[model samples]
Target: MIKPGSRWKSRVCTAEAVLIRPPKSEGLPQCGGVDMAPVGEEAAPADMQPGLDQGCVVGKRYRSEATGIELLCTKAGQGSLGFAGAALDPVEAKKLPSSD
Candidate 1:
């Protein structure tokens, strides 16, 4: 099981992220449509799909609504973060209310 604080690296790109919240379902997160590998493990060489190279921004948080998975990007790369077959959306910053 992927628990909070676990680190992962994209197999097909330079993207790296930390798991802030684990998914409700059991599975690994995907990047560029490929499963991510644990930080210290050897990842097999794989090619990213053509349209999946939208790029993951550094220092951004992405979340999956379907599985309740959340990730914080630690390194930027050519692959976008995703869960299952859907792309992970960037977590929106909460707006501060104005003081009266």
Candidate 2:
């Protein structure tokens, strides 16, 4: 269960994220096509699997409607974020109208 302030690190890439909106069910939040573990955990065999490799942009917001999850990119990396084989869509910031 990822909390609103929970942070996760990528397993294969130098990616990091913070959860804003979490899913109701326990859905694995993945980066580079692989599940991301908590920020701190016991040292385990590193996973060199490549996911989207398209890369993650810093300050970009990624969301998944199916699982009602949203995350903020803290650090940029050569990996794409997604879960369950579905790539998460980037949430574009809405533009403000100019006041003449």
Residue 44 C-alpha lDDT in model 1: 99
- Candidates in order, TM-scores: namely 0.88, 0.82
* lDDT score at residue 85, model 2, on the 0-100 scale: 60
Identify the leading candidate in terms of lDDT. Answer: 1
List, residue by residue over 5-56, the lDDT tens digit for candidate 2.
Answer: 8988888788888888987677777887788888887434355445477778
- As for model 1, its CA RMSD to the true structure in angstroms is 2.8
- Which candidate ranks first by TM-score, i.e. highest? 1
lDDT of 2 at 44: 46
> Cα-based RMSD of the predictions, in order?
2.8, 2.9
What candidate 2 gets wrong by more than 4 Å, as runs, is 43-51, 97-100
